[model samples]
Target chain A: MCQLLGMNANTPTDVMFSFTGLATRADEHKDGFGIGFFEDRGVRLFVDHHSARQSPVAQLVKTYPIRSDNVIAHIRKATQGRVALENTHPFQRELWGRYWVFAHNGNLVDFHPRLHAAFRPVGDTDSERAFCWLMQELAKAHAGVPAIAELTRTLAELMPTLHRHGTFNMLLSNGQALWAHASTHLHWVVRQHPFGAVALRDEDLSVDFAHHTTPKDRVAVIATEPLTQHEAWTAFTCGELKVFVDGQPLG
Target chain B: MCQLLGMNANTPTDVMFSFTGLATRADEHKDGFGIGFFEDRGVRLFVDHHSARQSPVAQLVKTYPIRSDNVIAHIRKATQGRVALENTHPFQRELWGRYWVFAHNGNLVDFHPRLHAAFRPVGDTDSERAFCWLMQELAKAHAGVPAIAELTRTLAELMPTLHRHGTFNMLLSNGQALWAHASTHLHWVVRQHPFGAVALRDEDLSVDFAHHTTPKDRVAVIATEPLTQHEAWTAFTCGELKVFVDGQPLG
Candidate 1:
């Protein structure tokens, strides 16, 4: 299976520590890797068909401290589409004057929806097609940019159709809120206030979050599995959809 | 004034040498810098609100050698919009299932069009507005991606409306061909057989094209001004629009 990593923070925070953990897992998922960083209304997306284990782009992401409020990343194993740069996640598109970033883990058997609207997939991936359909449906469901709660509700209503096809584990962000949907394996954890030292499960590297973060800093990380061994990671129930804002899951 | 650099090659080629020259000019045009590389149907866009001279992303771009068939780069001076990532060029949008990249050099005065279509400007800049308007009109003009000649003619018809507003020197590409329109200053050069050593105008960098290029390899480089010291760069006349495919301009 491919690997997915997402971060949502109350303040602009760097994901260097978490990304390093994810990159170590790129040995098996060597098809491609992509990461998107949201700086307010703007987004910076870096993708490579090369593996995160060796891609220079991934090296930059590991070293550069690009502080962002929301981030989505994926290391692909190429379940369906060919291993091309266009087919790498997370895919990006502009809708309602906001750039949306999406990354998917699980595959769909035959999830081809009619894309008659403005949103179209440049890549030949079931993931991108599903994303375009979601964008098209979202555009049709609302005339303008709707409120976050309304958008979340609309997404909740729209998730079942996609989940019915197959494993629909996905992470989506519009620089406002991050919405995560899982049909299979997915986990999340939040770190706040009394941040402690954390060690990566895949690598010997560890980070003292207490030294890097303030007492008020809050961060939520979602991944295919728990990246850190000691963290209180919570697994998502099958067919559950959750929205995260300000580093916490919304009720 | 901002600086613009575009390259369309018969084969996938790297622009590190030419981009180094452009980065040298970023001393004056230091609001931000962005470069978009078209690798087949995929695009790698790197934008930084910091100057290219100091940005780690730009440094990685300089050293990584990402080869592309079509490239559009801009180093901004921020005449209209604030120094923000959303306002950085070249702006990108998807139409007809192809990714189109655009970067503008000159500014416009009072050029606002009704953006009722799917295309919308995320940044508050006349250039982006003009680009959005162009995409809107192009979508309305053709049901799908048109032939290069037909698209060029439509652009020729569309140039005057934008040029009348103010200077409108711009470059656009959709991974197939590169289209450049000029109202003030724009130049292009084609380098092919018998490739010789060339020196950058601003930087001390020099490269011998004969070592890296084959006899049949052809490349066309477009910029606001000539990037090299010894090259036959042709200047575009007022209201002139040219389309380049496979490293040579089409009449």
Candidate 2:
């Protein structure tokens, strides 16, 4: 399966995304990869037609402590789009004066929709098409940027339409909140105050989060699979849509 | 004046834009900087709120030879918006299923225009506001992507309106053609067959075009000033809009 990772924090947090050196996981999703960080209203999107483990772009991400309140990363296996820079994810589009980042895991069979709006896919990908459709629908549903809860409600209604086509596990963010809808495999873990040393995988690099986090700081990390073995990661059921704000999932 | 750099070529060409090294020039435009490269239909934009001389992103541009057919680079001195990442130049938007990149060199005063469409500025910069207005107008002018001549005509009408506010020297491209509009200083130079070893300032690195270009390859470079001392750069007069296609300027 393609890999997806998302993080939303109360404070702008520096993520050691590649600190554990996920070389084994990279091989499974090696068509290309991308990562996006929302630093306030500005978005820094880094994408490459190379494996995250091998891309120079990824090297910079690993070395640089890009602080952001929201982050989304994806590794693609290229089920639909061709293996090129244009097809790489997480794809980005701007709507309602805010940048949206999205990444998907599963493939859609024949999920084409009428794109009669401002948003359109630059690349030929089912995922990009799906994203454009979602943005178009959202723009239709609201005149101005809506609150997170209202957006979640709108998305919950629209997601089922796409889910019927194929496996639709995905993650989305608009810098305000992180939205994840899973048709199959997706997991999340929330880290709160009194954080301890957190490590991903077996014998991976560990961070003494307690030394860095404030009592009020909370973080929610969503991925296709549990990144850290010790953390109590919660798995999403079929056809689940959840929104994360200030590092905590909201109804 | 804030510096703007753009390149359009028959084939993908490399640009050496370490404007930070232009300290005499940098002093005037040290607020922030950005650069965008169009690779096929895909666009890669790197922006930072740091001075070009110090930004890690600019350093990457200097170190890496990213080849593209169309490129736009800008160094901002922040006239309207606060010195923040969102306010960085070389702003991007999607229109007619193609990604459009824009960068402006001059400031506009009281340039408020009704942005009654999907395009909106994520930043508070007047430059971004101008860009959003352009996108909204362009979306309105054409239901689909218009021809270069048609777009040039639409822009000619729009340029005068914005020029009424203040300076409006700008560059825009949609991977098909490069357009330059000027209310003041904007220069362009075309390099064709019998390529020469082009050098900028004394300390600047030179490129042996003979080695990298074919006899058919033609490139047009537009900048706030003539980048190379030897080339005969043509300056645009007030309220003039010109489009460059296949590395040649079109009437």
Candidate 3:
């Protein structure tokens, strides 16, 4: 299985600490890794077939304080495709004059959907195919970019078709909001005012949120597993879909 | 105006020397910069609103030596759009399961085409708009990825439409081949067997190609101006479009 991490914040924030925690876990998921950051409508995507622990691109991601409002990252274990750059995670495409980024964590058995639209996967991975299918469906559902709530509803209606094939834990963003669907394993945490110190579950390093954040800043982070210890990480139930905006999940 | 640099090589080649020369010229074009590298069907794109001279991303690009077969890079002066990430050049989109990268050197005056297809510009730049329109037209012209010759013909037929608007010097690549079009300022050179030492035109740096490349290696480089001092760079006439494959331009 692969691991996924997503962040949506009310303000631009860096993911150096969270990404370091993820890279430490890259020992098992060593096929490849990718991350996408949305700075408004512009996106910067870094993908490498090398393991995140060794890739210079990943090293830059860890050290560079790239402040973004919406970010999606994935570390791949390669269940469905060969270990290649095209099969790396955090696939991105442009739609409706906006860029959409997606990353998946699980495999689907025989989950081939018709891709009759302009959206097509450049990679052979099942994950890329799934992302292209979703983009095609989303493009068909709306003439242009609709409201985020409408998009969430459309995605909610479309999730079951893919979830039935197998595990479907995934994260998607369009620079506006992040949509997380949990078929098996997913957890999310929101950091707001009165931030406290937290330690990585796997790494010995610790960081105090109070030192890096302002009182008005809010950040929500979603991952396949809780990245840090002693935090209010909420596990998602099976077959649940959630949309996060402004660092909080919508009801 | 921006500066454009493109490379198409028979084998994977690092652009550190060429890119360093380009970055040295980024002093005047200080709005932003971007570079896209094609690694087979996969692509690695790095863009920043920050100037290439100062951006950490550019620093990594210079030192990391990410080898690629086809490369498109731009240093922007921001003629039409604001100095933001979205407005940076070398925009990318996918068509027919192949990723296409584009970067423009000159401005297009009042050029807006009807974008009625899957490809759309996330950035509000005339360069991006022209690229999106070209993608849409290419998608419409073919059912899938056609042969290189067929694509070149289609593009040749479509270039005048964009050229009539204004300056349309551009470089485009879809991993299979690179297409460079010039309206005013563009130059190209092919390097093959018995390569010799070359010095940068703007920088004090020099590199010996004989030390790095095999005799079988062939490389075609395109730039707004000649980057090297002694290379036999052929200037492109206005409205000339050339397609390069396997490191050589087609007749």
**In terms of DockQ, which candidate is strongest?**
3
lDDT of 2 by residue, A1-251 (tens): 78888899999987765323343488667798888889998988888887877876777778778889999888888898788777888888889889899998899889989999999999999999999999999999999899999999999999999999999999999999999999999999999988998776844577788898788999998888888868899999999999999999996
What does the lDDT come to for candidate 2? 0.85
Candidate DockQ values, in order, are 0.79, 0.68, 0.87
Worst 10 residues of 2 chain B by lDDT: B16-25
Candidates, ranked, DockQ: 3, 1, 2
Better of 1 and 2 by TM-score: 1
lDDT by residue for model 3 over A1-251, one digit each (tens)?
Answer: 79999999999999999999999999988899999999988899999999999999999999999999999999999998898888888999988999999999888999889898888889898888999999889888999999989999999999999999889999999999999999989999999999999999999999999999999999999999999999989999999999999999998
Clashes per prediction? 0, 0, 0
Using lDDT as the measure, name the better of candidate 2 and candidate 3.
Answer: 3
Interface RMSD of each: 0.7, 1.0, 0.8
**Regions more than 4 Å wrong, model 3:** none
Docking class for model 2 is medium
Q: lDDT value for candidate 1?
A: 0.94
Report per-prediction Cα RMSD to one decimal: 0.8, 2.0, 0.8
Task: For model 2, state the Cα shift of residue B117 in Å.
Answer: 1.7
lDDT of 2 by residue, B1-251 (tens): 78888899989887864243332366557798888889888888888877877777777777677788898888888778888878888888889889999999788998888888999889898899999999999889999998889998998888888898999999999989999999888988899999888776635566678897789999998888787767789998888898998899986
Write candidate 1's Cα lDDT for B218-248 as tens digits.
Answer: 9999999899998999999998999999999
